[model samples]
Target chain A: MKKRTLISVPVIAALVAGVLFAQDITTWIKKTAGDKPALAVPDFRGAGDAQPLMAVFNATLYQDLSNSGLFEMKPKSTYPLNNPQQQGDIRPQDGKGLALADWASPPVNATHLVFGFATITNGVFAVYGNVDDTRQQTVQAAQLLSNRYLGSPVEADAIRKAHEFANDIIVKFGGSASLLDSHIYFTSSRGGAGGFGTEIWVMDWDGNNQKQLTHLGAQLAHLAISPDGSRLAFTSWPLAGGQPQIGMVNAETGRKIPFYNQQASLNSAATFTPDGMKLFYSSSASGTPQIYTSALDGQGFTRITSTRGNPTEPKVNPKNPNALLFVDGNPKEQIYRMNSEGSGMERVTNGEGEASNPAWHPDGQHFAYAWTRGYQAGEFNVFVADIAEPQKYEQLTHDGRNENPVWAPDGRYLAYMHTPLKSRNAQIYTMRADGKEIKPLTTQGINRYPVWGVK
Target chain B: MTSEFFRNRNLTLTATLLVAALFSGACGKKAPIPPPPAAPTATNTTPSSTNNTGTPGRPTATLTVAPARIERGGSVTLTWMTTNANDVSIDKGIGTVGSSGSQTLRPTDTITYTLTANGTNGSATATATVTIISPPPPVTPAVTRPNPMGTLESRLASDLKDAFFDYDSVNIRDDAHTVLVGNAAALRQIFMDFPNATVNVEGHCDERGSAEYNLGLGDRRASAARDVLVQLGVPEAKMKTISYGKERPQCTEATEACYQQNRRAHVSAGQ
Candidate 1:
């Protein structure tokens, strides 16, 4: 009996430890740490000879959800064996075919299931997607992504289809209000040797279709995409040793327009008002770098912020045209806000680190910014914080010199510049709000100041 | 025996649970970091990595100004040289320079210069100062046209002291009154010396405000500095004012010492 007791004690203790370890993983993504809604994307069924094309579509779709920052993708090992092909597979638990909620919710614990089909007709590639609620067993959104003339590369078409569908699912979740396509503008100096000046570049929001936009031949600093997304605003010297001034570029025609008054102001960090009617910037024409706004034609100038230590990166509140957001610090900086008339000054961040470059979400209640630990050797990371509550800041990046964060119009993602610590070579990247699903948008050169826009 | 056995099991289990809980909480990072994309990617477009040699060597530096004295607003050629140095910088914001080079500088007042060359083995520094001499009483094109410098330059063999202001404020300092008195007398003399020549009272600021706002602040400071000269019997027609907000720094160090030197109104002779 003594020996048996000894054996049972060891056996029971070991079993308890094993169970606890597994439990820890099960709750790893649970509600306290903020549980993510489980989403599943099954293999895209396609017509004969569509396997390779389907593989592209499948991989793209999977990658999108995993990085979306909102979804807890059900691991592939837990997925049902067979792919659901036709309408019969989708049930009306809430009334028509097989009850999908029952099938999807049980084994996979999927709150949302994304299943789609594809076809190649007359050399044109077409794809469709559907988002079904597991509990309600009802179709939330269904859309045909594309019907295009397949060029030589079928894989390219598949990528477009996946991007469109992912955007559709985002809408189903009541996220981004912007259209299906998006891009981020950044500055890079990758084209030349070390001393060569940086130029402006743009790439797809999901990190593809990269292209250079401007070749200033001189150093470029910061940039902004116009509200309509057809134009871009940037700062660079026209000549090698000239002063940096604001310049505009047409996204489509690629016509570079230096401000009519090229020497109008020593300007940098330009942003357009939500209506795109007026543009705001920091100018030293008056001696000190204060915030100013002018009509799109560069008239009707209004001085916005007059605080000391320079107010830079003036962002007009999308929800409140009269409100403004900016950064102030001669040495150590913090984010601040005031009215259009430069009244009611209020500090938005406190306690630690110099916070600069505040990017407002669509809601206008919260903002994201880059913070440096101090004026020492510490690097920078991106943080998202509420304007109403200063202390409740969420760190969105762990380690890296991430700066100049801009929000996607949909409010679901943030795009910013990421540089390895102590490195001058920077790249543009996008990540979901939860800091998950990080995807690089630009792979080359010293990139900085990325802004998401429709163009 | 039953009670003892239960106690032992419970203690063991509790300790195991504590260890597991700590392990779970230790994760402040994402798990299963994906491998980086294969080398030689299509776009290795990173620019300006600045692959520093990181090795240090004994450094030596030399700084000089051509004809180290000049009429106000006149230009001077500045030449600097260094040996066995990794980095070189001139005191007033002419940042990290080459081993040897020349820059044409226009200083409104006397400027003290300092050049520092840094290397791993050690660092070396050298300084040279430039003096702005008022031109021989400007040959007055018209006695009545009202120039601001000729007669004044004669009375003040010494350089006219520039009036300084507080940070972000355009109010002239009390200490600058004596300097303004001499500057005013010089401008009055210029009216008799060189009528067509304009004395531009340029405002400047510490590199504190937005470059744009600093321009406005500098203008205010220059305007304020001009106020003293105007009150001291100098004609407005003889003086014009502008602001170079925070752009032209008298010192480039990121400290109060340098910033204080930058916030002042400078008198540059301009058309």
Candidate 2:
């Protein structure tokens, strides 16, 4: 809401007064784990032909970094003495602006400096990105060789590539790595039958380049993408009035197959194990939905959680394979961990509304889930909690009814289903793990069950 | 909202897939409900179906299925409606259903599912078919694909009765025994007719409970029915059990009757 960026002109007198202003505006230590790292994103300077994209790259890179919610970027107004292009002496690999730390450290208040040069040669458009870690005094922070374009529309998205550099910088400072070109797999009712039922959709982290993966033309009960991002397992009544069963659709091909069809039973939440060799699915073949692990080929079936309530949504920890998390107990709080063998059960999150839809951040120690106050109908908000200490948690979204917060691979961002207080239509929304910079991916028609992964 | 349309406009060519689907029979099996050309676009015709038709407080019933003739063990959408009815029940173990809704039914044999809707105007009855048409002869090394010209000499999921159970318990009820007796007869007929045929018994529960544990509870219900069916002379080797827990509910309503209907054991063709 803070108008994405700040840009204002100064008169001669204003400039004279500003010229005398000098303070350590950059290298501020990050006080909290969720604190946004102070960063400076200068224009991705380019030669003559590429000058057309200077503004585009600048605004795009600035917005992308700003949208990441990991940086407190210094505006262009404060960037006069810190030009990376002025001397060409600051190599992108040497993480330098004006080829000197003193130029970017204090007055700009940037703990990290993200500067780059954009160039277009013959038919290729490219950006040379650099980062300056002033504290480490590391000359070569990190460089993204190429995230360029070849043909028409053909202008380089230098800033788009720079997002990777910014994310790398964020990760280096102990933050989640997102905005570096990750994809979000969500449900959308875009071009389905009569534009009717919701279909699984894929899009870039910024909600761009969205495409339909499966024209299910049916309501999706639960969705999980294979670890490799090649297949999608969904629950829905493909036949009118038919029972919900597990169905698989090729992620790239969108070819749907009734994967594990247990006739007349509900095969709701089906997920693939991290190794992609086994699929953890909740089958009601035994009257109650118990967690079952099966080979990807649907053989060698074994039961994991055979306890009290129906254990649905068995998510194997992304970091630790032996540790698993699912919504269990009679009341259904998430954060319940068990060995991959489904023993040594421990309840992590309790008395925090109805916790459901737990997804582990790449770090097995931390996870994000949805908490509803009373019943399943109550307004739900997303929260991130540690497995070691479930009580220690951070509530994420509050603007709407948010549920099923799933973590992206980088762990800095999550995608969830959000239905505003006034509307019945639920849209897919992705936000930073800390819950800032909430962005809705689909603008129309009942999108739900979003899972973020990569191919 | 094809993400590819934004990534590369060329991939938008898949948009014509729906057109190709219309001319091809295989696509029909893929997409059961292909919308008409003038289907609603701006605002979806609300999914919540209401019966404003028939006698205002009386009971009216409408039962229909798309593609009534399906391959053996294939699926069919059985949509049924009832208006101003205090009670709506369906035979074939669907039990108490919503006043108006649709279900995807995989009937192996040709069967007519009976619905009874009762209101102040007394009761109304309707029936829908889950028919299994002849499929193509089985080819060696069965390919995992929907066979457009597939034919079969047998049907399995629909012919048998679904055994109903109680809440939070997998114990079969006295009334359910009657249904189980009939289900045993059906299973016996299938076994006698086709020696290789095996039954996949599915356990289901109402939505009132947690989505996780209900799976085991559902399995208990299905296994309970399997035990009774086996005792009634159906071979135990022919039965395979699984649970859906509370994930799939026949009647999604938060009511006693709906829960009663959801808590049951369903018998169908097995994998």
DockQ of each: 0.03, 0.14
Docking class of 1: incorrect
Give the best candidate by DockQ.
2
A1-455 in candidate 2: lDDT tens per residue? 11102212322232244334422111111122246666777777777677786786677667866766667777767654546642245543333345445444556666666666767787567666666564544444423222332332233455555555556556666665454656777766666454235578888877778887777677565778887777888776543334467778887788875464543355767888888777888776665566788877556777776665656778987766766787764544445666677766656677555677788877665677777645353356787765555665677776537877887776666788887656656788888666777888888776777877775
Off by over 4 Å in 1: A1-35, A90-102, A136-153, A178-180, A192-196, A262-265, A330-332, A351-353, A373-378, B1-271
- Poorest stretch of ten by lDDT in candidate 1 chain B: B42-51
**What is each predicted model's overall lDDT from 0 to 1?**
0.65, 0.64
lDDT for residue A396 in candidate 1, whole number 0-100 = 74
Residue lDDT tens for model 1, A327-419: 765444567766666766666677366677788877766678777655332256787765555455677788846777888877778888776
DockQ of 2: 0.14
Residue A415 C-alpha lDDT in model 2: 87
Q: Determine the iRMS, in angstroms, of model 2.
A: 5.3
